[model samples]
Target: MVEITLKGITKRFGNFLALDNINLKINDREFMALLGPSGSGKSTLLYTIAGIYRPTRGRIYFDDRDVTDIPPKDRNVGLVFQNWALYPHMTVFENIAFPLELRKVPRDEIERKVREVAKMLHIENLLHRYPWQLSGGQQQRVAIARALVKEPDVLLLDEPLSNLDTLLRLEVRAELKRLQKELGITAVYVTHDQAEALAMADRIAVIKEGKILQVGTPNEVYYKPKYKFVGWFLGNPPMNFVEAEVEGDYLRVYSSRIPVPSHYREIIEKLGIKEVILGFRPHDAQIVKGVGDGLLGEVYSFEPLGREQIVTISLDGVFIKVFAPEEESFTFGEKVTVEIREDRIILFDKEKEVALEYLYKD
Candidate 1:
């Protein structure tokens, strides 16, 4: 097992800067995920750790050893690409054994290691099958087995499950998490899929535009995001935002005015923030049937999803979604109210677009 660290890491492709002054410490035997959208420099960060792309500036360390100048072959890291790069010409066994063969391991040891990893990945039965003859799931298992056969200290996966079907992806996702824990190996996964990172990683580093926005556990990032972008980027239906202006002790939202909660008043007064953006998750809102101390809106649309439904409400010209039980029914343009959970509401500076620390009272 190894604890990987990247300090002041910066990667530039000529004039285009890919990674900006990145500093992170990946704990030993920890599962860390690099999550971002496409062209967000997540893949570049992974390759840099694998010694495939040398950083323009900064140093990489595995535990206490600085490996800034080390070659990929000497890094002792296992890398699984998005497109499971398996050789179609070779059988699964041969593909898994290729790494050991490169080191000229005795033929007997190579066979033993290949079989061992194949069994671990539950691909032992398909060892004799070529890549062309196997299913996508089987091929991905083979790719993982090939990486694991070398007993690497750190495992790096670049969206390895992106190509698989939903069911197969879930299966592989669970298996990978289980195997990482069972083997006690340090792992770094790169993916833009928020669900995958939330379900699997011990900690997630949310990256955007070659810079890490936030690094925290799943619950921390989901519930108490440091940046407004982090909150907006993580949720399923995404968080809803509404512009508000401080009007005396009340916050004016559209034509309605609601009293400022005691928890947020101090901070708003301290910062003297007049204009702010109020964010609340769909699940954190209560859809009331009548007029009350809440944002007034009308039901615009309904999307039923088995046990629950997403109710879209139009507050004047602004629209927001609310999660309601399936039993709750509403007609088009029906008058309704949305009561945002005051404790769960995230207040952000309208200009800076960053979260305000207003829950300190609790």
Candidate 2:
């Protein structure tokens, strides 16, 4: 396993910057994911690390050695793409053994390694099948097995599950995670799917416009987002942001003004922020009664999602969603009091889009 490091990485195409000055360290044997939107430079960074693209400026290091200029073949990295990229005429066994064969492994050793990896990936029974004869998931496994057959120092996957259908994607995702853990391979996985990153990564680097916004565990990024963008990017229903003003010890959201919880008073006071954006997850906003210290909004619509419902409410013309159990139902145009648990409230500077720390008073 090798720790991959990128320092002062920058990439440009003519006048457009594809990747900004980016610095990241991925630990050895760690499953690190680069997640962002389509134009967010996640794939660009992956290709740079894989030696497929030379950076406009920056140095890449594997462990202690600089490999910024190394060729892809000499990097000892296995790259799996979105497409299965299997040879149509070769059987699964021959495809998996192709890499070892290229490396000139003896015939007996190739057979042993091919069977071992095939069994490990649970594709041994399908080894005799041609690429056209196998299902999408099976073909994906064959691609992965081919990548692993060489015992690469690191593995790079660029949206490897995107080609599969929803159910097959889920199945392959589980299998990929299992295989990565079992082999203890240091892997860099690039995906735009937030759920996939949340489920598979030991740590995720959220990127936008070729720069990293934040890098943290799923919980940290979700619950304690350092930036509003990070918070808005990771959740299923996404986070709701309400424009608000900070006054003395309270925040005024729409027509409803509530005192900032006592615990956060010190931080609010220290920051001296007069204007801020209030952020809260859908799950954190609840419906309460009797004009509690919460926003007053009318339900606009509700989407039933099996176990829970996403309730959309309008506060001062701004729509906000709340996740409630299926048992909790609200009707359109119904007046409802929305209670935002103070502890779950995330504050951001509207202009900077950066999270503001809450100072707790004892």
Candidate 3:
């Protein structure tokens, strides 16, 4: 297994900066996911580690060995491309054995390694099938077998399941995570899908426009983001932001007055932030019938999602969504109270667009 490290890595395409001073340590046998939106430099970062694209500045290391100048073939890293990159003319066995063949392993030994990896990926039965003859999921398994047959110390995958259907993606995702754990190989997976990173990675590195914004476990990045963008980018329906003014011991969000919890009062005072953006997730707040000690809003609209429904409430002109159980129903233009969960509130510096240390625990 290899612990991959990038020290001040930077990449440039002429005047365009693809990566900007990236520093990360991916642990030995860790499943690390590079997650972001399109054109966010995630793919470029993965290829840099694989030795396909050398960085313009900085060093790449495998464990303690410097491999900045090593050729990809000598790096002992297996890479699975986004498209699977299978040769249509080759049989499954041939595709999986190609890497071993290039290294001139004995014919019998190549067959043994190929069969071994095929069995591990459950593609042994499809060894004779050509690429054109297999399903999308089958093709993906074949691609994985091809990468794993060499028993590489580090494995890198670039959105390997993006082409598969929803159900197929889920199945392959579970299998891939299980396979990685079973083999105990250091892995770096790249994807724009938030759910994939949350489901599969030991740690998630959230990137944006050639910069890593945050690196943390799914829960940390989700519930305790360091930046407003990190909180905004991670959640489905994302996090709701409202303009507020700090008024004595309370925050005046539009017409509602929410008392600042004691835990966050000192931090807020220390920062001397008069204006702030209050952020919260959909599941963190609740809607109640009639007026109470909560934000006054009217039910604007809602969408029923089987077990639970997403209800959109209008705080004056601003809208925020709340997750409500399916059994509880609300009608349009109905006056309701939106209650904030005191412990779940996130405070962001309005001018800096950065999160404060309000989540600090006693």
List per-prediction Cα lDDT, in the order shown: 0.92, 0.89, 0.92
Model 3, 135-168: lDDT tens digits are 9999999999989989999999999999999999
Higher-scoring candidate on TM-score, 1 or 2: 1
Cα displacement (Å) at residue 323, model 2: 1.2
Q: Write the per-residue lDDT of candidate 1 for residues 1-362, one digit (tens) a residue.
A: 99999999999999999999999999999999999999999999999999999999999999999999999999999999999989889999999999999999999999899989999999989989889999999999999999999999999999999999999999999999999999999999999999999999999999999999889998888888877888888989888989999998999999788888677888988778788888889999999997887999999999999999999999997999999999998899998989988888878888778776732332
Tens-digit lDDT track of model 2 for 36-86: 999999888999999999999999999999999899989999989989799
Q: Global lDDT for candidate 2?
A: 0.89
Clashing residue pairs, backbone N/CA/C < 3 A, model 1: none
Name the lDDT of candidate 3: 0.92
Measured against the true structure, the TM-scores of the candidates, in listed sequence, are 0.97, 0.95, 0.97
* Model 3 clashing residue pairs (backbone): none
lDDT of residue 232 for candidate 2: 88
Task: Give candidate 3 misplaced runs (Cα > 4 Å).
Answer: 358-362
